[model samples]
Target: MTVIGWIQAIVFFLLVLALTKPIGSYMFRVFDGQKTWLSPLLRPVERLIYRIGGVREDEEMTWYAYAFAMLAFSVVSFAYLYVLLRTQKWLPFNPQHFDNMTPDLAFNTAISFTTNTNWQFYSGENALSYLSQMAGLAWHNFVSAGVGIAIAVAVVRGVARTSVKTLGNFWVDLTRCCLYVLLPISIVVGLYFVAAGMPQNLHAYQDAVSIEGFKQTLTGGPMASQEVIKELGTNGGGFVNANSASPNENPTALTNLVELVLIFLLGAGLTYTYGKMVKDTRQGWAIFTAMAILFFAGFMLAYWAEAQGNPLVHAMGVAGGNMEGKECRFGISASALFATVTTDTSCGAVNSWHDSFMPLGGLVPLVNMQLGEIVFGGVGSGLYGMIVFVVLTVFIAGLMVGRTPEYLGKKIERREVQFAILAALVTPVLCLVPTAVAAIIPPGLATLNNGGPHGFSEILYAFTSTNANNGSAFGGLGPNLFYNIVTGTNMMFGRFAVAIPALALAGALAGKTSVPEGPGTFTTHSGIFVALLIGVIVIVGALTFLPADSLGPIVEHLLLLQGNTY
Candidate 1:
């Protein structure tokens, strides 16, 4: 890595780390009904929303009722979005006269965004009206992100509470998450995006006379609002077809920096929030520290790989290492490094294309996904995943020491550890096993856009994408109905499977009796524990993925430089 890259990485890392504690503290307050200066600003808006929407703030539901309500709300959202996409030509503000999406495609798109998968099989403007862009898609971006945050809060509350049957009021947590945390920040950033050149137009998509005199219609939207939360929530769907890399969507270097920061900020802070809620700031920072390490490591490797130039081109005397998939505007270092970090965290808004990556460069993202992205994985998802692993780490440590693991003075017992293990382990189970099955199935090889080791990589990537609930695709995979069914199943299992257990684990921990800190109490806040936690994270990822990665990237590397076709 260049000195600048190192500087960029370090400066960014510390900035994120510094923000995590206070933001996390603020988040805990938001969900738990604490106050900040921003609360007053947001509170009236909160009341207005409840009054307008018939949201009963005090009408708390039991866990089942809450879960059911979430499902119902999401279902309504999916239906509305699906209908909008399927009939946008008739909808107002559709200056482009976009055609209706195919039923399968519409379903995929709806479920994708509703689940916060934000998977785009179709381009935005070509498939959606401006009204749908704001009402259907962007609105869900806020609510979906709020849902994930609320779910995480519920789980934490479960852990912090004692013998509590109720995790929390779903309506309350969701409202506060949107009102106090997501909305305030998003509104400010959205305005910034507009000022930076992202379109906030009521104007229709119009035919633009190209320099070549070919009339190509241009697409624009109320992109600024969606663009803000899309990154902040780690929901990677793009406002335009080009995603974050879109000229209008992310106009300048400063906006680019803001986008990157937004993608990671909440995830990092949530780690500290976890620590704070548990009364151990050290624990949260440890998770954040580990994520920082993995992210930078990938960034360096991506930069190096791109800088090294493609070996195939070297043999053929082509000069560039790996710039094929990257936007020339961004160049190698910016493209590769940004992609590495983005994919590393399950924030899949690619500033560069993955398919065009030099084999090894592409492999980094694939492997990062397989690592379960717990190194600050997705926005809310990533932090929670890492914490789940931490719980398992302490549990394992406790087992080794013949004493019970206690995280934040709450004993990590059989139930807590079991659920934590479930949260940590299930994604891999969904990712790898489905990958194996998909690869062995007769139809699997047919999905590949590139053959040989790269083909194998595509199958692995597909499973990783689905099970990670990340909607980004390798340009190679033909994610047809078969792939869709498989991937959608993966998305559902990947999301709900871990989440339900995590919430359950939190409740279990809360019910447990606290053990006072003793000499043997395994101080999770100490630097030593942070290092150990990182060790545990690395070990889990490596041990699980060693062979799979060997078959995919490691072999692909040998094929690229060593001159093997397969």
Candidate 2:
């Protein structure tokens, strides 16, 4: 990576780590109902929010019940958002005279956003009105993220409890996730953004009369409020179409720094939270470190690839290499590193276009998506993905040692491994199957804005973007009804398919007693195990994508970079 890219990434990592511990610690208190300075302040509001939302504080549900509640909640959210997007023209604050989104487009968006996928088939500036943007899309950002975190807390409860019938109250977990963790962080970050000059108004869209006489129209909303959780929740959708890459939206360098930090804050903090929840902080740190190692490795590779520049450019005596799809001002180093980090983490905000990236540069993102997005993944989701790797690693280790596989205090039985296998395999099935089907279909082929081998990459990216629920796109697929319907179905499976099994496994683990941390207790937080964990994750990814990647990015690069036209 360039010095600047490394510097930016390192700075963001340190800052996020620093902030995550404190906030995540406080969140521990908030959810546990432990006394804290803000307990008096936030507790009343928390209680009131529960009452208003009709939350039953005393009620807790089993794993199945909690999963049901989550699905039901998402279903309701999808209905609300779809209706809003379809009827937005008549709602209000639509100064652009924008019409309703198409039924299929609205269906795609409703699913994309509510699942924390944030996948975009349609342009935000053209398709959505301010009312729908704020009330529907932005609101869902908070709720979807809340769902992820709630599931996380519920899973933690399963780990903590000793064969309890109930996991935790779904309503309570959701409330704390939203009110205590997401709400507070988002507000502070949102206010900081407003101070940094991002728009924060319910005002109608404005027509800006620029000094250079360029007629530029502006979109404004309760943008700051939405932006905080959008990053903190790992929900990468932006209030405006440009997402975080837009100058006005992410105005200053400091704002960029903060946004980067926000992307990882919870993900890093959740590590510590895991340790605390399981009464084994080291385990959390080990998993967290493993994720960190992978992230930095990607950051470095992305930097090197961009620095190599395009051989195609070099052949033409172009001054710069690897300039394709990158902002001239952001430069190769900054753009490449940012894309890698965001896509790896399920924080899909992009500073550069992915479609125009050089083949290897593009390959980094594709591999990240294909890897189940385990590198610092979504707030709750990334941690879960890595844990699956941890299980697989333990299983492999157990076979060698002639002992049963175990993690933390729980024995890793066939049932848990079965679920882990499901979690591990779910994303690939969603991505590869849809990609294969799309590349053959007339509509999917028609969706390609760019043709040839790279065109295949666009279709692959759409399924990748949707299945992974990482919103950033290659910016080439037309993604009409056919693409949307197929991709949306995959997203539902990709998200909940992996998650439900995770909760089920957590309960299964909870039923088992924590065996003493004997000499054999695998130190998941430390050196050898961490390395092994990463190796296993990489191998899994490589095995899954080798054939398909050869068809798309690898071939595209060979043809394009070698100066041969198909």
Candidate 3:
């Protein structure tokens, strides 16, 4: 990649690093029930919400109670969104008079958003009305993210608190997350997006003649508001089919950078929040460092592969980086960076199509999701996901050293280890099993756009993305009844299967007393531990996914080098 591109990537990363502490600290206060600058304004509103919903803000929940609340909330969210999508034609904001979504599509879309996996099968502008966009999808963007953050904070409490059977109040944590964190930030960023030339209106799609003398329908809605949370919440459902790649959604390079930052912002910040909560900033940094290492490695590989372009194309007398799927404004570097960051954090927004990338370039995003997207993962999900691995890492370390493992002074015991292992296995089993079933079936292959290994990659990527709760698509496979149903199932299982187990682990840990550090205690915040953590994460991902990957992108890459195209 060009030097300018490298500079941009470095600056983007540094900006995220720079903002991590303040945001993390602010979030710490928000979740810990402390007052903030916005307390005066939001406190009344927060109280009113609790009153209206009949929520007891002071009520704490056991891990099972917390999971049940999250599940119950999700069920309601799914029903509301499903009904909204299925009946959008009758909805108030149907300026385009868009038809209602089919039962399967609605089912999939509902699960997608509720789980924070905003995987769209239909084009937003063409299929959804403004009411569905805002009242349904955008609302989920805020609350789903809030739920994720809330769960993470609870998990952290499990690690930090001793001899406690209760985590924080789910309703209160979710409320504070939305009020003090998501809402305020979204407002500011939404304003900036409007100022940066992205549209923010409820006007009808304007019909106009282009310079080419063709009529065009310029899509319009409450895009600015949705666009902000779409990234800020790591909810990548685009207002239109083009997603962030669309000019109407992401208008400029600066906007693109900002979207990238927003995706990683809270995720990176949560590392610090974890550190602060655990009374060890270094622990958070150690996790941050491991994530950073993976982030850079993925970005560098993607950038390099994209820069190398397609050798087959080069044989045709073309040279320079592969710009096939990338936007010219952002070029290879920025697009690669965006892909790396989005996939890393489970934000599926794309400036470029992964399917158009060289096989190896496309492999980066695939592998990112397969690694469970814990490299600065989605909002609250990333921290908890990483912590799952951390638990496993320390357990493995404990076994090696012939001592019980301790994390932040809490013993990582049998129940915790079992739950951690269960959480870790969710991705591989949910992803690979469905992928295998789809690869050979007629219904699954009906929409396949490419053949051979590349086609296999597309299927593999779909299952991986959904199972990771990462909504980005690799393209090629057209969404059909089969995909909608299958991926929808994957999304639900991926989200709750992992989350409930994590909460269970947290609950188990919460009931335990903290032990004093002994000579046998493995220091978790050390460089050696970071290295081990990375090793555990990498090894687990590699062992589970490598064979499937070898059959898809890896084989495709080798084929491409021999001037073959699938």
Which candidate has the highest TM-score of all?
A: 3
Better of 1 and 3 by TM-score: 3
Candidate 3 ranges beyond 4 A from true positions: none
**Highest-lDDT candidate:** 3
Residue 104, candidate 1: Cα error in Å is 1.5
Local distance difference test, each candidate: 0.76, 0.80, 0.92
Instruction: Write candidate 1's Cα lDDT for 484-506 as tens digits.
Output: 66776677677778767776676
The positional error of residue 83 in candidate 1, measured at the CA in angstroms, is 3.2
Candidate 2 residue-wise lDDT at 379: 79
At residue 434, what lDDT does model 2 achieve?
A: 81
RMSD of each: 2.3, 1.9, 0.9
Give the TM-score of each candidate: 0.93, 0.96, 0.99
Writing each residue's lDDT as its tens digit, candidate 3 over 300-382 gives 99999999998877888988989887777888999999999999988898889998888899999999999988988998999
Please identify model 2 stretches exceeding 4 Å from their true place. 208-213
Report the C-alpha displacement of residue 538, candidate 2, in angstroms.
Answer: 1.0
Query: How far out, in Å, is residue 465 in model 2?
Result: 1.7
Q: Candidate 2, residues 1-566: lDDT per residue as tens digits?
A: 45666787787778767776786677677667677775677888988988898888988788999999999999999999989888988888776778998888888889988899888777676677778877787788888888887887777777677757677888887877777778777777788899988887766678898998999877766777777777887778877667777775677667777777777778788877877888777887788788888787777777777778877768877766577766555677677767877787787888778887877788888888888777778878887777778889998878878988777767888998899899888888888988898888888788687877888888888788788888888887776779878877877787899889989977787677767778977666679899889889999989998888899889987897658654
| Model 2 global lDDT (CA atoms, 0 to 1) | 0.80
